[model samples]
Target chain A: MTKNILIAGFGGQGVLFTGKFIAYGALIEGKELSWLPSYGPEMRGGTCNCSVIVSDEPVGSPIVNEPDVLIAMNRPSLDKFEDAVVPGGDIYIDSSLVDREVRRTDVNVHYIPATRLSTERGFDGIANMILLGSVIKGSGVIKEETIPAAMSKVVSAKRQNLFDFNIRALALGAEVLE
Target chain B: MAEKVLMKGNEAIAEAAIAAGCRHYFGYPITPQTEIAAYMAKRMPKIGGVFLQAESEVSAVNMVIGAASAGVRVMTSSSSPGISLKSEGLSYMAGCDLPALIVNVQRGGPGLGGIQPSQSDYFQATRGGGHGDYHMLVLAPNSVQEMAQLTIQGFALAEKYRMPCMLLADGTMGQMMEPVELPDSAPEMAEKPWALTGTGLSRKHNIINSLSLTPDELERWNIDRYARYAKVEADEVMYEEYLTEDADVCVVGYGIAARVARNAVNAARAKGIKAGMFRPITLWPFPKAALNKLATTCRAFISVELSMGQLIEDVELAIRCSRPVTLCNRTGGMIPSPEQVLASIEEAAAKLN
Candidate 1:
């Protein structure tokens, strides 16, 4: 089945990087994928988002009109994209930033305090990865085992010391629900 | 030994150009296409290739002409407005019969338009953006993978015809990322016998001049160039046909618009409407004959684009209005959704009845 995923947050929230990691995981699993960002001026502030498609077949459109999974890292992102999730799809809301309840009944909603938990653990900049960890567990779109290697490939060598932190963040995210 | 790695479309084009033996890149920075220049700036130096950022788009195109005349594979990239600035240099390159690759990662257009994805440059790209009676072999890539593949093809075609070739992508294709298998080695470059590499005393000097003092001589040059363009048209038409067999409506588009149209075609089919898509991979050669052939079978045609019916005109001309040709388009940087295209397809299907 094809999975249309949308990840959105502020400009510095690693919205694009979160999408890239999932895209890389999809690639590692030999799935066809496309990652298209909200480019130009719209990428400046809290409205930044990216559309990702992971499919067994070739993707028709990189732009996701109604996503199967919506990862909203902020209140504005959740408000803007929550309704666009497909019926019976999944929506992950970063509860620390988004206090509003999900208004949809047809889909599953997981509210994780990604920012609060990450900051408590002293991993300030990788709340997106923590949310991504929940996304992997919540959606089952990709295997959890595939993420570390994908993260290794995506993170540059200069930042290699943060590799363990990112991996730990992913594990912490996965434990949010369990 | 092809290695698959995820890369943004602009970076893939830069790497693919290097793999195609392109040793020189000259371009000014522009939104949506700046990544191409950025990638070249970072990688070209390490590979011993020349990557010079010109003061303006005009100078960049002129630098391409200069480098290409020296018999090296050279390229430059820009967006819609910058492309307009480079038009004069493009016409000059065409007149001189130099080989160069020009990539237009098109954004909204006319003059200083927004940096959103747009196909507004369709007319400017295919119908000779530059002055004079010259044509550029325009390759339209819909995906990041095609962005890499077509850059290689663009360089080869430019060398083969001794003419400038364009990789006509848009902001969507430029910024998107996908897993692409890069070529293991640079393709073998064609020898340039008439190149203006220094003439040793043993050989006669070759002049690279577009200025023909005599009108008759210029006319002769134009005629010869037209003949070569005709050969390119006959041999290099590229397109992709999806579910065209026994379809009542054929949707035609290219670049990112084509990808959106493909989804519309599938959605239309799901609703029991006979729909298909004809994607022009080569926008200049246009795959007109293939489209014309489909017009005989399909009940009608819908030209989908991110411009105000730029490609539709060519679609009508190609089919000679034999089929009812209609347009489903969005202009000024708006991308039409699959539902929007489906509405048009359904409208076109209803018109047939």
Candidate 2:
């Protein structure tokens, strides 16, 4: 089955990178995929979002009307996209910032302190990776082996050390849902 | 001999125009298509050519006009909104029968739309993009490969017709990387004997102006330019018809949209619905004859675009509205998927039944 996944958070929080890792995982798992980033002037400061589709067949609209999975790394993201979840779908939020409980009972809501955990792990900017791992743990749509390869492809030559931090973060976050 | 290289659509256009002996370029920086300007800025000076980033689109097109009047091969590029500003200069160039190339790496919208790929400029391109009763020789490339090849073609067509031709492309075509073969035997630019180069002692100076005082003289120039355009339509109608001989439906599109439509046709055929695609390589002088012929056999047409229906009008006019045509699209930089196009085809097929 095709999976529609949306990842949203403030810009520079690695929201887009996290989604890219999942998309790469899907690609490695031999799924047809498309990743579309939200285009707005406030791409850097405001709510940054990216949508990914992994499917057995060709993906239709990359813009999801009802995302099967929503990964919100901040309170605003969770509040904005909480209703976008399909009935019986799942929502994963960074609970440290989103103190309010998810009122929707139609789907599963797993709150993770993604940013806080990354900070605790001494990877100040690896929250997106943690969220990605949580999604993998939560959805199980992609194979685990592909995360590292995708993450490496995205990191610049200047920031080579990020691979270790992100991988460890993903592994720990994935362990949480289990 | 011309060589082959893998390049982005924007860069390839820059390379090809240079190879075609087009030495003057003027443009403003814009995303997705900025590579063309970047490539030119880097290379043009070394080749003893002119590459100037003008203040804006208006200044850029006008600069191109000035260079062209001086008997130089020249070009400029911009996106949709920028092209809108250049329309006035374009109309003037058309009126004066000035030969030049204008490339629009089209993006979405009526205003400063986001810098993403879009083929929404169909009407602006085909229907006298700038103004008046004039028409630009518009070429639409579906791949980075053609992006290089057609830029050369646009320059030649402009000179041949003594009018500016537009290489109409979108951001995707501008940004995508693909392999391309460069043309062999670089073309020696045609001599402009009547150009505004200061007349020597023996020759009469020719003035290149769009405004003519007398009605008769202006009418005469219009008739002559139209005659050249007619010849262009007769000789330069280019299109690619894939698996269309016995198709149940035809999807008409150009540029990146054509690529999506091709994938859609494959999906539709796999589902046992006979489908095919007619990709018009030229947006103006818009492969009308070929589409009309294909219309005789195909059940209907689905015009897949990235914006509200624009090219559909041409498809209707080309076939004289003989068959059904529908639209499948996404907007604001969104591209419709193969399945979306197939859905539209199936919906159109259903109505036929």
What is the C-alpha DockQ of each candidate?
A: 0.89, 0.07
TM-score of chain B of 2: 0.96
- Candidate 1 Cα outliers beyond 4 Å, as residue runs: A42-45, A157-160
DockQ of model 1 vs. true complex: 0.89
The 10-residue segment of model 1 chain B with minimum total lDDT is B182-191
Tens-place lDDT digits, model 2, residues A1-178: 8888888889988876676677666655667666656654556668888877788975433455578999888889888989879999999888777778888999998988877887787768777777778888779878777776666656665686766767788898897764
Taking every candidate in turn, the Cα RMSD to the unseen true structure, in Å, is 1.2, 5.8
Give per-model TM-scores. 0.98, 0.72
Clash pairs (backbone) in predicted model 2: B2-B184
- Candidate 2 C-alpha error for residue B168, in Å: 2.6
Best model number under TM-score: 1
| Candidate 2 Cα deviation (angstroms), residue B127 | 1.9
Summarize candidate 1's per-residue lDDT along B184-237 as a digit string, tens digits. 777678889899899787699999989988999999999999999999999999
